[model samples]
Target: MHVPDGFINAPVSAVAGVVAAGAVAVSLKGARRELNERTAPLAGLVAAFIFAVQMLNFPVAAGTSGHLLGGALAAILVGPFTGILCISVVLLMQGILFADGGLTALGVNILDMGVVTSVVAYALFRGLVRVLPRTRRSMTAASFVAALISVPAAAVAFTLMYWIGGTTDIPIGKVFTAMVGVHVLIGIGEAAITALTVGAVVAVRPDLVYGARGLTAPLKLRIDGELVDAPAPAPAREPAAAHRSTKGLWATGLVTALVLAGFVSYYASANPDGLEKVATDQGIDKKAKDHASKDSPLADYGVKDVSNARISGGLAGIIGVGATLVVGSGAFYVVSRRRTDDESVNSDSRRDEKV
Candidate 1:
């Protein structure tokens, strides 16, 4: 959930800001390993996709609604480092451009929404992969479980943060119960999206999915008497993409995101998300402050010129898609370039040593 300004007190918010800064710093280095020629571009689109899916708030309870948190989906599709960066970029864009999340509470949002979910989801996914059958189905199963846990983990994290630096005097137990209860329902939705998305990618292009790197078990061979493990074959220099038309995938994905955010949001459940619902129900939202971007021309996804909220929202949705792609592609490009340079240096060093 996007934590608005003033929900958390100044000191706790500052601590979260520092934590968020450190996470981003670590991700920059970690991304050097994750981003490759193939994955870098896809990572950006993953961010936009997350942003889009988040707009479609499915009904969780009678009133409460939940949306995709996307940490597991991103981590399964891309790499963990890039997944964190993807979510971080979405959070940044939402805060500054859409005025959805709070400026002052940006750190809180990043730490809970970015750091908690990515770290937990990836860690769990890896652990499950080791024990589960090494197959695409197993990967999807792991993704579902990982995503399910990550959502509640975020809710718990927020509850803890609120207890420490809550602007209001609401009891900690109440926050915990409410946050956990609502987010549990939300987690189911996240799990479904993550499993389906991971399954789809792994079905077509398992090579492109970072989490499925070693999913195919090594072949066992037998000659004459005893069975032996076959030596691993070298990967092809350049594997052809499974699909004949990537243009279709891109078009379908982008269109789905735009439709979800711009038009479908109109039908989204009106109940506040887990965080907002808990905060307001428990009186924590009393201290919430107006977003700094309140005066901006595009505040709340409504364009200035478009009288129809639908048209204004639709235009903003398209703009968000373009912006996320542009920024995400640019960031991943730098990461990919650095990776290339490192590989070159390593190769040269090995040659010199051998000489």
Candidate 2:
């Protein structure tokens, strides 16, 4: 949910800003280990895909709708650290470019949506994968459960934040109950989207899905009438055909994102999302302030002076997807480059020691 400005007080919002910044810093470091030649660009594509899918809000209740939070899907497709970055990039773009999320409440949105969802979902996903059968089906199931829980977890986090710094005097209990209740329905939507997306990726390129990695059981051999693990295969250089396949996958993913955002988004539900519904019902928006970029050309996911609703929204969505891809890819590229540089330095140091 995109928390608008003035929902949280200055002090609590500032503290949340600090916490979000620290989390982003930590994720940047952790992402160095997750991003590389094969996965870095895929991570960027995941961000763009998440941005696109989020535009297609599905009806959850009578008037409330829900969209992909992308935490579980991203974490399953990429890694948790990079997943956090992906969501953060989307949030940042929405705030500054689309005026969808408030600038003042950026930290709150990032903490509630990006950090909490990714961390909780990834941890639960790992646990479930360990317990369930190691198969693509199991990965998809784990993704569903993880995403189902992550939405409510984010709702709980926002409730706690409101309890501490809510501008209105609405009873915390009512807010929590309404928030959790509506979001529980929203979580079902989240779970379905996550499961389908994860399953599709696992089917096409299991190697690209971080959570699907290592699910394949090692080969077994019978020697001297005793079962034994076969020797692990040595790492082999990626063949040119595999490289072409990866390129094909990337092209396909980008095209899919473009289609989803550019055209399909026009038919998405127009109802308010889970958080907006809850806020309006509970008087949480009594003190909500206007977004600073409300006058931006692309504000409210529409182009300025564009009479055609379909065209305006379509252009905005396309712009958002493109901007997110560029910024996300650049960020991941830097992280991946840093990792390569570190490895080169370490190798050099070891060689000098031997000399």
Candidate 3:
């Protein structure tokens, strides 16, 4: 959930900012090991796709709506550290450019939406996948459950934060119940989206999905009409062909994201999301302040002086997708490059020692 300004006291909000900063720093280091040649570029597309899907808010309860938080989906497709960075980038972009989340409360949004959701969901996903069968179906099932829990976990996190630094007088119990209740319903949507997306990606490009790596069952060969476990051999392929396949998948994903954000987003629900609804109903939003970038040209996900609603929103969405892709890709490339550099140095040192 995007916590707008003034919902939390300055002291608590500052503390959250420190926590968020630390988390991002840690993730950057962790991502060096997770992001590689195959997955580094896709990280940007993952962020852009999350941004697009988030625009298509689905109705959950009576008037509240929900959208993909993308933590579970990102963690499953990429890696947990990179997934955290992906969602963080989206939150940062939304806060600064779209005036969607509050600039002052960026830390709260990052902590709740980025850190809590990614960490909890990935941990749960790994646990379930380990216990369950290592198949695509089991992977999808684990994704569903992980995504289902992550939303409420984030809701609870927000409740705890509000209890500490809430700007208005309200019963914490009531706020918790309402926030959790609505978010549970929202979680269903999240789970379905995460499962379907993960399933689709795994079906086409299982090698590219980080969670699916090394998940294939041992091959059983029919020897003399009896099935026997066969030693697995590494598959060989042309580098150019593999590169082409990755490019195709990337292009297709980017196009789909563009369509969703640039055109389909215009038809999304106008009602408040789960967090916003709960805040409004529970008096948590009484002290909410205007976004710092409310005067930006693209504030509120619309271009300045653009009278046409569809065009303005569409342009803003496209611009957002482009910016997020560039920033996310750049960050990932730098991390991946550093990893390559480290490997090279180690390789050279070992060679010199052998000499």
Candidate 4:
């Protein structure tokens, strides 16, 4: 849920900002491992895709609508650290360009949506997958359950935050009940979309799914009529970890994300999402402040010069895709470089000792 600028008080917003900043900093370090040659580039696409999908608001209740929070989907497809980065990127873009999330409340949105959802969902998904059957079906099933829970978990987080920093004097218990109840319905849509997308991708290329990396059973061979385990291979392809060239997957994913955000975002549903609806209904919008960038040319996804909604939104979405890729890819490249440097230093030390 994108909380606008005025809903949360200054103290709460400032605290959230620090927390969000810290989270991004930590994720940058964690992402060094998560964003490799394959996943680094893929991370940007994940952000863009989440942005596009978020545009499609599914009806959660009679009036309230819900959209993909995308934490579970990103975590399952990418890794948890990168997933947080991905969603945070979208939130940042939306806040600055689209006048969506408030700049002042950026930390709150990131903490509530990015940190809580990704970390909680990934942890649950990993725990369930560890004990469940080692099948793609099981992976998809776990994704569904994890996604289902993450939404409500986010709602709870928000409720707690509001209890602390909420501008209104409304009872905390009522707010919690309302927030959780509406979000439960919203979670279903999230779970279904996550499960289907994960299942389809896993079926096509399980190798690309970060959460499924070690979960797949080895490919069994059929010798004549008997079932047999394949013979072990040389170190070129170590069984210790089945490493695949992430380059191909990264390219394909990036291309798909560009197509979706640049060309396909035009078709996304135009409606207020769950948080927006609740805020309006609960009168939380009374104190909301105007976005600082509301005057920006591209504010609300409309390019200043473009008159056509179709063209304007399309162009903005495309620009976002390109920008996110460039920035995200650069961040990831730095991490990859550090990782390589560390590995090289280690290798050099061993050689020096031998010499």
Q: What is the Cα-based lDDT of residue 259 in candidate 4?
A: 74
> What is the C-alpha local distance difference test score of candidate 4?
0.80
TM-score per candidate, chains pooled: 0.90, 0.94, 0.94, 0.88
lDDT for model 1:
0.82
- For model 2, residues 1-355, the per-residue Cα lDDT tens digits are 8899989998999999999999999999999988897778889999999999999999988988989888888887889899999999999999999998888898999899999999999999988987876556677889999999999999999999999999999999999999999899989999998999888776666667787556456323445776555443223674676778778889999999999999999999999998899889989999999999998999988999999999999999999999999999998999999999999999999999999
lDDT of 4 by residue, 219-310 (tens): 23344766444333324556334344345555666677677766777776566777887777777778889999899877887788888888
The per-residue C-alpha lDDT of model 3 at residue 342 equals 94
Instruction: State how far residue 322 of model 3 sits from its true place (Å).
Output: 0.8
User: What's the true lDDT of residue 114 in model 3?
Assistant: 87
- Candidates in descending TM-score order: 2, 3, 1, 4
Local distance difference test scores for all models? 0.82, 0.88, 0.88, 0.80
Colliding residue pairs in candidate 1: none
Cα lDDT tens digits for candidate 3, 287-353: 9999999998989889999999999999999999999999999999999999999999999999999
Model 4 weakest lDDT span, ten residues long: 227-236
Determine which window of 10 residues in candidate 3 has minimal summed lDDT. 227-236
Clashing residue pairs in candidate 2 are none
Give the CA lDDT, 0 to 100, for residue 162 in model 2.
Answer: 97
Model 2, CA-based lDDT: 0.88
